[model samples]
Target: MQTDAANPSLKKTLGAWHLWGIAVGLVISGEYFGWSYGWATAGTLGFFITTVIVALMYTSFIFSFTELTTAIPHAGGPFAYARRAFGPSGGFVAGAATLVEFVFAPPAIAMAIGAYLNVQFPELNPKTAAVGAYLLFMTLNILGVQLAATFELFVTVLAIFELLVFIGVVSPGFSLANFSAGGWAGSDTFGLPAFTGIIAAIPFAIWFFLAIEGAAMAAEEAKDPKRTIPVAYIAGILTLVVLAFGVMIFAGAAGDWTKLSNINDPLPQAMKFIVGENSGWLHMLVWIGLFGLIASFHGIIMGYSRQIYAQARAGYLPPSLAKINPSFRTPHRAIIAGGVVGIAAIYSDELITFGGQTLTANIVTMSVFGAIVMYIMSMASLFKLRRSEPALARPFKAPLYPLFPGLALAIAVLCLLTMVYFNPQVASLFLGFMLLGYAYFWLTHKQREAAPDDALLQTARSLVD
Candidate 1:
């Protein structure tokens, strides 16, 4: 098999801290927005319960997933783990899911970004601002990985600080009565309707910690895979868990949480209720809250591009996407390809609506569907690898053996079923996208075989072996 020397590889400059930034930054936008939709369905109390369940699921999932990431240390992340445990077809499923999660997520964030900007400058078209965000971030990614990562780290720190500020500013006016009123989907008690509302709210709860696993995609670029990845994943998830709960509870308690539901700028609206419409804190949130959106948007752009490049190099996608820019040592083609898809999704906001939901809500649910699937595959891969490759080098074993991964897998399956039952239209769209991608992989597998000596293809073989 051709060695890695022959394949175009990413530059290695990322350390534990940088990986932490990527991990948290990829999902930080969840705290700022996209999660309030749960309130529309589950009410404040019910959504809080949902968030707690989802947080536990993520905590376990991240711990178990760290084992696979440290061992494989590939750009494909979960795709590599599943490919080694199952086969090429397994890789395709994981890759497609990861692509969907990463690609579809940004358009939602971009639209949120547009909404935030529009709050300040009413004349600015939100769609135009969304597209501009795409262009600016894509250029930053194409410039280089280190530069992009550094920028992500900077913005992520700013975003975290901004969330703290939001929590503090809103704390003074927080009223438990305001939060608990109609908290159980406005029902008098936790009846059947409230129970089903919690089930229906699963996807929005997932939006809070959706893309934390994207950090694993940077394994190939990390300075030390085993050690650095664990630190990043652990610290990243902990930080996000604190911020997610703090922001959610404090924002919900600030005033009548019901009005914040169904809006993209929930933080600003929450602050406006606490303070006044013209309060400086509210204005600050509209402006500084953008760092949260930008962090996730930029970080996920890094993630999806690497996933596309890795799969293309392995013959799961078009070969042209695998080519790294000679100067930047980055997957320029892959970055631009994902950007184009995201930009198209941005323009389709009004063109694609379902069940009277806003474009952001629909897109967030779609992305969460992809994420839950990827989590299931990754957890299963972890189990299979343990049984099949008993001697595989595992620098960091899962702390609880079968227990951690088993819980994660179980929660993920339940979440998927609940989401599918609640959002059949979005679920159908997700399934259709997966089936279409699988069909392409099935038809093109043999055709890609004609180029047996391809260096990148050989590298893929060596890595899988």
Candidate 2:
């Protein structure tokens, strides 16, 4: 009988640019917009320096992903790589971590959409707006991946155009005097409060560049995995980095750092300052950018569902989740399962705490912690693959090899440590989830052992050719 590895079901409809659109759609909006606003809170110099650090860290992450994706171009991305290197248990943990990121991100994006809409229509309630937007994206994702990718490409192009126009209009108002006023370490000008605030802001800064490897996760579905995956992964990161820096520069030029801190909608605020209050064109640009948030939520749901489906196929998750719909050829079961979990997450965040902290804050921090863990594991997988499968045909190898991977690992570890030390509540929650994953793995070990290894080994060896 022909093996499953010889006839996997996922069709390859994505090209290099389409894959690039997916990653850009996932990472470039939502939280990054919030991150840009957070920078204004710290002043221009502090924000600029911190953003550069975060961008470099993201570049390290991309390098690590590029190596692993090239070594093992499988449907599950990190989950598959971890299982092959360590075991089924490792794969489960990786999949769980990815689920954590995806489940929490949508509501946060919804919240941002709500906040932006509130800015435009001050009388509307933010929570109601957020839930409504979430429902719309959920419907879009259900239609299919092609629609999701197409929506993402449209949003990304519009976002880029809006950003360029914002920069062009705002740059002429440049004020070098405002550039170095506060300084990076938050000097005497802003006092000690500013210094600690910048340190506290690290996680939020890193969150902007969170999904840089999103394209690679969909590698198996791309038209030509070897060539397209690498191109999309690299190009997508470069595009986002450029856009981020442009926004920072323009915001710094149009208004003083203190003014930016008070404004949640920086792009609109900057545009208003440059063109004055009567400009309807600037308002339209801001509204277009807000729509990008909806596109982002749709892209994330698609990526997360695929990860869940891949893990289910490997027996790390229930087999029901592995079922693909014959008509759509999409992992319909997994998509429904992911949506249900996501809705639960959204409701859980509505609960409150005594200290003004909400469940949403806790979930966001846990997601960040989980992302850090996955990054370390994925980077280590690259190093392991270099030793175990040195003969594998890699169309694109990470530049600097051991050095780059080592640096990436070290930075990811630091971020993880910082997250734990800074917020023990979320850290504890992350540990608790990991423990639960371990217990589930223990229970499922027997099933994994009884399963055939022929399919798994064939999948691994295919990379060697």
For TM-score, the strongest prediction is 1
Listed per model in order, the count of residue pairs whose N, CA or C atoms clash below 3 Å is 0, 0
Displacement of the residue 81 alpha carbon in candidate 2, Å: 1.5
In terms of lDDT, model 1 sits at 0.89
lDDT (CA) per prediction: 0.89, 0.69
Q: Indicate the residue-level lDDT of 52 in model 2.
A: 73
lDDT of 1 by residue, 94-158 (tens): 88999999999999999999999999999999999999999999999999999999999999999
Candidate 2 on 1-465: residue-level lDDT in tens?
A: 132553336656778777888888887664335665445435666667667766887886786688778667776777777777776666777767877776667666666677778877889886678778766776676566676677878887777777777778778787767656664534443455465446545566666676666566677667777788778888888888888777777676776655655334667777677788768757775688685676567777777778777777766777677676654556777777776766666566544221244444454565677677777778877877778778877778888877777887887787787668767666777788788877877898765665444334565787676
Compared to the true structure, candidate 1 yields what TM-score? 0.95
Model 1 Cα RMSD, Å? 2.5
Q: For residue 141, what is the lDDT in candidate 1?
A: 98
